[model samples]
Target chain A: MLSLEYLQECYGFNHSKWKINGEILDTEKGVKRLTNWTEEKRVRWHVQWRDQLAEKTGCLTNRMIQTIHGERIILSDAGWVTLHDEVTSLFSYKNRENEIGAFFGRYFSLGMQDVDTEINDPYANNKLKIYLQQSFLTKNSTEEMRFLEGIRRESRLRYNKAKEIKEKAGGKQEPIVAPIRSLDQGKVVYGQFYWTNLKGRPEKGYGSLRNVLTEWLQRYGQTSLFSLLNEIDKEFSLKGYHGKNLLAECLTPWEFLEYVMKTRDVHEKDELLVWKEKLTYQWEASRLLVKALGEWLDVAQEKVTV
Target chain B: MTYEQPSSLAFSIKESVWLREGEEIDELLSLALEPDISIREADDQVFIRGSLLLFGEYKPKEQDSNSNSYSDQISFRSVEEVTMSDDGIGMIRHSFPLDVTIPREKINRLEDLYVTVDAFDYELPGKGCIELEANVSVSGIKHERTEEPEDTYDEQQDEESDDYYTRPQEYNDFSSEREEMNERSFHFEAVREAAADDETKDEYESRVEEIKGESKEFQNYERNAAFEQHYEEEDQYEQEENNEEPVSYNTDPEIEPEYEGETEPEPEPEPAPEPELVRSEPTVNFSPQPSPVSAVEETHELEEEGEEEAGRDQTEKSSSSKDENALYLTKMLTKGDQEEFSKLRMCIVQDGESLETIAERYNIQVSNLIRMNRLNEERVAEGQILYIPVKQTPTSKS
Candidate 1:
């Protein structure tokens, strides 16, 4: 995505045997990449994050190289361009769970929390009813109808539970600035996890925590979730409001909403099976996330009482 | 609030079974393993069930002269300690121990939950033995159940409800998350029209018959038309609310304006990861990123060394008639210039030496020693002889 001339002029990397391949530029210095983000704030946050992570935890992220103009991001015609010293080789961690947990622990303690707070209505799914109607029209078989009913019932229950939890927690929890790593956003490179090509907007909320934990369970399963939470607890105590907000966020039927929205493009009878499978998978991931969080909170409360 | 959360638990089972007997396994022909697994709950516990199908060629013994092949499809339960062999045809009893806890009270209404078994690392220790090691895992989700009346699609109730209309699509650059989560709605008037067409039954049948003759081409065109229509509709919706909301200034507005200038001074290069402009703390030193080498080249070098090992044993046995004066070098196969010996170097292990140090001393790769000597591991006993490879160059036949 970046030219050799740009790397030479902007970053002072002049190698005779340089070539561009995909998003990376192979130069003598290291692999330089073009990030997918153009937002100045998120880009700045990522640059600083890579620096701090490498400094504190001895983890080598793709550290941004400053241009001749002393800028991390250059405003080119193609948008914001950032050249990083990309670590290409894989680095194996001795204890993957504990080490990954330790890296995240240090990250949570980094004082870069955002102050902007605008709550999104998680229960607002006006399109779901339309999707439900469309599904009924298309898949009118008795068995399919029963399946739809079950899904609808589950969604209603999740919405009510999420509302109840939010009401109980009230506004006691202070939002923390955290990176939202969606399922496709998180990557494992250079022996550690990176929020690769981060597309999620910079935010300060408990939603990011819920999103990250959900992603971990989706990618790494339950053991990683437990170890991650436990290790993060050792550094940044996830005891009171943070814990409650995470629990409430978990109860939000984001999975059902996401899948119901997908029904707009699906028309094939066989595709409904795939649609059902994905919804079920998401539901399972969400349930396990909630269960793990519930168990963790129970243990935390016991420790507090003792 | 006391939330009705799904109970989470874990289980593990390990079982080793004799896959086959009698026939000695000659060569593993093919192994076909698919993770088409299902999870079931019984007696407040969850169990994983799957089948492993393997086909292999065997060396038939003297008594058995009919066939020299064995193909068996074995099915096993994750929880069963003792299981029947498939069809009672073979004597191989396979049962893999499984410890799995599925959160079933609320999320159990579903008929089947697919549990994926990770890729197995299989090994053959001896004849007629297949050892498979794999981790079985069930991962995340949440579902809720309640005793209210079951939800049915009531067309009358839907028509009466005020929430039938879709939201006007608004374009906002900052809130990409919200935009991604936004759903599109379509009216069901098309479905209603198709249903109420009472006078075109014969016309519809004739049209369907005509289309069936060129179904393949029609299907492609129909699929393309649907995609184009969907995209065009999305673009039209986006265009309707072209200027509904300006870019939000909620996120650090001051930072964007500051980056417009090119006057920021670069900090002195330090042995740390701290950027010059950002807030700095006491930095921890990290290892510099290693230079990227082509993984292909490394594997190529390993394969070349393997080829060299195959020819080393014959040369060692043949090179016995060496001159006493030529102390360090010996020539074994100098038939032509192409077959001349370069030189052979050997090292003896001492008390305080490792394979790595010996490699470093002789300026040869450790892999060359291991492959040449056929060493199983990196460790070497004291007073062991380690052969090192010398530089080889092509020579003309003299």
Candidate 2:
């Protein structure tokens, strides 16, 4: 799936045009809209806010160290230490009762081994394929296996949606070194949920995934994503699936792979396969965040009041 | 030279996501579908990479208000042979196979698919399937070359070539031509002086000898008188001026000789007979410039230049102001260069006024207005703005 990050940054709703049509969903307080802003003013605010969001989240990658000419480096040593530590700690658990739990735990650990050439660690592009032949991917047998499959199936759908958003924004996902099946999040699930300020919370006012991301960035400014990525070294961002051209400005997921390989100090292809689970979890986590934010703040249209 | 060109493919592909046989759709966590296509030329093959981007909130039959959607991507890769243009300019097309379906059989794929515009996502409230449209285009693009290559310009060769002109020649030719023109007046003066009275050689010699003898006697007498006065006044002036500082000598005192030249004793030499004018065809240019050969002759020969100039002056003096204007215009045209001292004046057409009439009133050529304003009609309507050249008649040069 693609990252809707660029679109989120570029597009914005005309919130200044929003009128208070009905009472706020949770309270009797009527929806308040400050519509004194002109289109230019609103757009300016959105662009600036998006920039702030990108600064906090989009600036860092596990590939290489980026220089800002300011005091802040793109990725810091402290951030890398945190990310490596967190991934190894959180992703190294044994599978629990959940059918796909073991698979998730084994793949997500940041301490991945060097992959050999002869082994299979599918190159990570945005596109992910599921090999149902793997017992963990298909829902069969017990109810637990079925639950794992359902989560994966949903994750896959979300991943594609994110991918579409990425492509629409005139970009592609970075090459990742993992299995297609690993992209599904049945293995590791981070239970963090947030609410959006959109008109229809549970129903259809949810704007496009891109719209949601943009709203999220507009509201929170990537602070959550920053925390999610767990920071990395600036030097770490310099390495990725991208060719020698080092643009630290572009934060790609392949930077995760680079971080994994380097920190683990492994080059074996099979070792890369173990990462599918963790990378998949990461992708799912980001998608959920984007979706959550998209729903809460999608103010593009007028919806029926509760 | 392989230059990248961007071409867009406008195609529509449609697919549907069918809910299970007896399930009502409700709320989706996320709903998204994006169409994507990529171009890759590798390993002696050109392939198109296509994928479907699907994610978020899926409510198939509206059974529940807060249901979640599946998130994943469907991808395909293939290549179809496309005809390339000879000049390599048009039609570098590559098509790849694409297939998409929901994993849970919540959506059923359509058979005999003839759908285009495959990018759309919406709920099928009572319906079993979520129909999606996929329509995306591919465009070929070439990266811009950053640095501009230097042009292969050769100045020396351009100078030696006949089809070119250089700036240094303009400077040199302009100065020398101006000097040559100035010499024409000098030559005219010489010619005018030569055309004076004639006398025999014997008479001229006798007259010169007589004047020389008289001049010698007059000079000797004047010098002897001056020398005596200087000696006598030296002692008196030395003490009187020595104390006051040496008196500066008055240099080159003017002497006025009486006008006795009414009848000169020295006979003047005879003027040369006027040369017969040779008649030659004048080379005319399609434009107003005079032929180079005739121009050169006019500048070099004083008599010819004088004759031509005299005729021109007489014609100018006799002409009326109107005719003078015409002459001035002709001269201006022949010069082929004029500065725009005034702007191109705009005029509005009045009712019942035609282009020809307007031009006549302004004393300007109708064709000029047409060419300047790029008009196709010979007539203009009232209040229509027309841009005409300024009709500023040049004042006569002093």
Candidate 1 wrongly placed segments (more than 4 Å): A16-22, A48-58, A88-94, A109-111, A115-146, A173-197, A204-208, A211-224, B1-398
* Top candidate, metric DockQ: 2
Query: Per-residue lDDT tens digits of candidate 1, residues A1-306?
Result: 556686678878777234455477777776667665556666676677667666876765556778888888877666777776554443332236677667666766665554333323333446644443333323334554545544554455455555555665677634434455553443467445654434344455466677777877766767677788888777666776666666767766666667666764777778878887787776766676777777777667777889
**TM-score for chain B considered on its own, for each of the candidates:** 0.23, 0.20
Count of steric clashes across candidates, in order: 19, 85
Candidate 1 docks with a DockQ of: 0.00
> What lDDT tens digits, residue by residue, belong to model 2 across residues A1-306?
111232112222122212222211111222222111123322233323223322433321111111223211112222210000001112211212131222212212222223222223222332234321123323234333333333333433333444444343443333211222211111222432111111111111111222323333333445532221222212122122111111111112332333334434544556544554455544444444444333322221112122
Question: Ten residues in a row with the worst lDDT in model 2 chain B?
Answer: B219-228
Task: Give the alpha carbon lDDT tens digit for every residue of B1-398 in model 2.
Answer: 12222222222322234334323244443456553534344443233334434544433221212222211111110011111122111121112223221111111121211213324545442344443333343222111111112212233442332122221211221221211111110000000111111321233234234322322100000100110000111111111100001101101000011112221111111132212111111110111112121110011101111112222332333242222111111121111111111112234343456789866755666775564444666766543445443312122000
Docking class of 1: incorrect
- lDDT agreement of model 2 with the native: 0.25
Question: Candidate 1 on B219-313: residue-level lDDT in tens?
Answer: 00000010000011111111111111110000000001111112211111222221111100100010011011100000000010111221122
Task: Give Cα distance to truth, residue A280, candidate 1, Å.
Answer: 1.2
